[model samples]
Every structure is written in structure tokens, then in C-alpha cells.
Target chain A: MNRQNSNKNNDHRDDFPGSFRSNPFHVPDHYFDELPGRIKSRIEQDKSRKRLFYLRPVVQKALLAAAGLALLIGLAIALLHERNDVHVYIGQFNGISAPDIEATLLPSDLDEYTLVSFILETQDFTGMPSGTDITDEEIKSYLLETNNIEPLILHY
Target chain B: MHHSDEEIIPLIQDESTREKGFDRLVKAYQQEVYWLIRRMVIDHDDADDLTQDTFVKVWNNLDRFRGESALFTWIYRIATNEALAHLRKKRISFSFLALEKTSTAAIPEYNDAFYRSDNAMRQFQKALAELPDKQRLIFNMKYYDDLTYEQISEITGTSVGGLKATYHQAVKKIKKKLSLE
Candidate 1:
């Protein structure tokens, strides 16, 4: 099949007026002489380029990982400092009267809801009797003794 | 100086003789490779750059070349791909109308004393430059380079039948352009 095609192409070439196979282009004198040296230089340059090409991604990824680790460490340190501040502030209030501690530590502008939520979060209720175990009479007696009767009546 | 693939391959595979083998390879095939690219690009400078690029690829990939095909065939394949890629990039940078103008502009204007003597050859080159990149490639390989359709297929990764059709179309176009038909 290739032979047939080659023969056909030959016939096609015969139909042309002039030969196209002869190259009309000219190169500078000694172009071929210098080509090998130029190619060798190019190959050396390419080798250097490829070395940098392979190394660049590894360096970029290492830097990115290091940056990420630094950010996480920074966040953890900030969080630890914030927790320590809260602990030290509370520790300074030891032996102070409850009203005095509240007046000094809490802002006067704090809303009732915020104060209630804050007290609920900080107060320990582990040893307290369950609501189902408390009698109505006990609740009334505790409210009266604590002078919370007027507020309780108004809330009801 | 004129080393065949059989002699060249082993020397290139060895560490000590690799550069020498590569130099011999360049000397042996550089003109053919340059002309192959020159005809496609129509500019000597572009062809020179592409020829050097082709050899650089050959040097870099020689280690993985398992001698599956002839060395010239592999090298020709690389040159063909480089030429096509260069042409494609040129086309992309220009509008369709500008691409046509650029293709014609890329052809040297026959101002040289040698080129001025050959008006017919200049016309032939103009006709060839007017061809679409792949069609011109097929025509150049088949008509000018005297390559078999099978060899062209190996280089282009096109089926022989498809190459034959493209070659015929290219011939028809060139003939019409030259007033031969």
C-alpha cells in the first residue's frame, strides 16, 4: 500500500513545473558549524532551569506549611493568654465580699440578662438538691430568708 | 563523524560518551532537521530556534528512547511537533485576517540576489505558506521531503489514509494557486 502511494506521489511530482525538493532558503555562513555549540549551551541552560523548576514547588510547599503552623501556634498562644487573664482576675477577688466583688469586677452598664447568664455559667450547682426534691415550703422559706420575696412576687 | 543510530545510541546512553554522541548526532542530522523546520516556518531564524529546540529535546529524552523506532523518525517527529506548535501559537496571537497577512509576511520578500533569480520558487513558497499548517506539513513531508505516507503517519500520529487525503488536498490547492491545474 505504501509503495502504491509513493508511486502516486512521484507521478504527482512529475506534474509540477519545477522541483520543490530543492531548498531555496539560505543560512548564514558557518551556521551549521556553530549550531552544535549553541545547542550544548542551550542544554546546559535547560538543565539549570529544570533543577530550579523541580526545586521551586518543594520550597513553596515547605514555606506554606511553616506559615500555617506558625498561625496555629499564634492562635493557641493568644487563647492560652486569654484563659490565664480570666483565671488571675478571678483569683484576685478571693476573700472580698460578694457584693463588693460584683461591684468592682462587673460593669455597671451590664444588663440583667447578661448578669444572670454570667452568674449561671460561673456558679457551681453540683451539690445542690434537685428541683423535684425541693418542697414548695422550702423554696418559700429560702426566698424569704434571702429577702428575694418582693422580686419573686413581682416576677410571678 | 557520520554515526548511525546503532553506533550513536549506546554512546549516548553511557555517561562518558554521551556529549560526544550527542554532538555527532547534531552534525549528522542538523541540516535535514533545519530544512524540515525551515520549510514549515518560512523564516530562517524561527527554523534555527526550532531546530535547536528539537535537538535539545533529543538530548534530554535520549535516556528514555527505547529504540522503538529509528532515531531519525523520532527526531523528525519532535521537529514536526515543534513546528506545528509554533505555527499554532502564531495563529492564536493574530486575528484570522491578520493570521493570513502574517503568514504571507513571514515569507521572505525575495530581496536577496539569489532569491530574486527564482521567481517560480518564490511563488511556490507563497503557495505553500498559504496552506493551513497541518496541510502544508503533510505536503512538505510527502512532496518535498519525499517521505512515505507511513513515515509521515509515524511522525504525525495520523492514519495513512487521512494523510493521503490531506496530501492530495494540499497538492490541489498548491496547483490551483500556481495555475498548474
Candidate 2:
């Protein structure tokens, strides 16, 4: 009966001539024995990779925020510096003493004609009484009465 | 560890039981996954790397598993995708080194005393390597893994009728290539 069964198996093989019963591939010694450990290590490595993945965006966001903060601070410093310059410029005029103001006046600004003309232009004549023309002898009498005359010459 | 997917999925889903459950899942499915990739790539180291890659994807994506398919099928799908992608890259980069041209030389000799000396096995592997990628996958899954059409369908997203036809065509091709037609 076993011989007959073997014959039947042979007949089956003959019927399907392309059937393969054996594996052609082979793995190294104890490959499966170490496969579990390798897989565990690979998993640990993958977890580390994932940790880096999670940290990357956070690091990028932090750097971006820091950059933005630095830019804001730089802009604020520039604005404050500009404001200080304006204040110093205004203070040059507003905080000066009278002597310093006179010291800063140009030679042309101190011209007698120019000063008198400026005074005449600025004075309000509406409160003053109207005056008639005065004679030179009247000016001389006033100077003599006030003892403000110099005796050098009425002829010149 | 040898529990059904019903028992395994919950453990993988729960944080407390997740690692142990994954270890058990790997222990159960590693051989199957390895052999599937091994037959597809025909290189041990490549197959091993692809196997690990497949499991890693499974570990990362287990939370999104909806139980629409069997756990093994889901795992197989991941393995299949890895193998096919690896092959696609290998093909493009090494197109000049087409396996069919050097199929005989591609058979690796192992360091063991148990090196395969069978001509039929060598011929079978060569014939298998000559098939198109999907046809080879169908043949390996159907003939070698003894996977059912429904299971293969779930893994491949191919219909049972289509897979049957593909398997039939692959077998015919292999038989003709082996001069057994």
C-alpha cells in the first residue's frame, strides 16, 4: 500500500510537472535567534529618530521666535536712538543760557541797523501817542538838562 | 504570544501591553514575513532588512489599524509593499545587472555544509525570477506560502478572481520556462 501511495505521488508530480517542494533560499546561522534583538534595537533607533523629528519643529519655532524678538529689539533701539537725537537737537535751543545764545549769534545778526529795524518792525505803535517832529536844539536841551552832553563840539 | 488577532490587537492598542504584544506579534509573524520578502528579493540580507522595515512600519502604524482585515494580512501588506518598493529601486539602479541575464550566477553559495545541490530547485528559482513582479508575488504567496485567495486579496487589494488568473498564468510561465510545458 505504501508503494502504491508512492506511485500515486509520483503520478501527481508527473501530472503537474512544475510543482516545487523545496525552498531555494537560505539565511545565515542563527538568524532568527538574533532577529528579535535586532528588531528591538531597530525599534529603539526608530524611536530616537522620531524624537528628533518631534524636536526639529520646536527648535525651528524657537529660533524663529528668537530672531523675531531680536528684530523687534533692534527696531526699538533704533527708534529710541532717533528720538534721543531729536530731543538733543531741540534742547540745544531751549536749554541754552542767554550768554550762550548771544555767543551763538552771527556777526551779521548783531548789526545795529538790522537790530534796530527788527525792533521797529516788532514794536506795537498803537499804544504810543503820536509825536511831532522835534528840532535838534530841543535834543541838545534835553541832553544838557540830563547832563548827558559831551562838550567837544556843537559846531560839527 | 500565540494568541489570535482578537487577543493580540488589544494588547498592541493598550500602552501598558503594547511592547510585549508587539514582541509577540513579531515572534509569530517574523518567519512568514521574512520568507515572503526572501522569495521576492532572492537575497538574504535584503530580505532581512526589508523584514525589519516592514515590522517597523507596523509598529508605527498599529494605532491606525481599523481591523478591516486580518492582522496577518495587514502585516503581509506592509511586507509586500516594502519588498515591491525595494525591488523597484533595485531595478532602476541596477537595470544593467538584470537578474535574468545572470540568474545562475545570482544563486548564492552559503558557508554551511548544507548548501542546496538540487538542479530542480535552482531551475525553479530561476524560473520564478523571470516572472513579472506581481506574478512572482502571486506565485510565491499562493504556491509557497499556501495563502488563500481571500487572504491574498486582502494583502494585495487584488480580487480573488484576478489573483486566480494571475496565479494560473504565472504557473504556466514557470512551467514553460522550466521546459515542463
Best by DockQ: 1
How well does model 2 score by local distance difference test? 0.71
TM-score of each: 0.64, 0.64
Cα lDDT tens digits, model 2, A24-124, are: 55777899878988988999999999899999999999999999999999999999999999657535644656555455543223444433343345444
Q: Put down candidate 1 lDDT per residue, B1-181, tens digits, no spaces.
A: 5667778878888879988888888988898799889878766888899999999999989888877877788999999999989988877231224544555445342333125447676566667777888898888877777788888888899999999999889878878978862
TM-score of chain B of each: 0.84, 0.86
Tell me the TM-score for chain B of model 2: 0.86
Q: Tens digits of per-residue lDDT for model 2 on B135-178?
A: 98988887767677777888899999999889889877877877
Question: With candidate 2 superimposed using the best TM-score fit, by how many Å does residue A6's alpha carbon deviate from the native?
Answer: 23
lDDT of 1 by residue, A46-105 (tens): 999999999999999999999999999999999999999976865564466766755663
Q: For residue B133, what is the lDDT in candidate 2?
A: 89
Q: After superposition, how far is residue B1 of candidate 1 from its true place, in Å?
A: 3.8
**Top candidate, metric lDDT:** 1
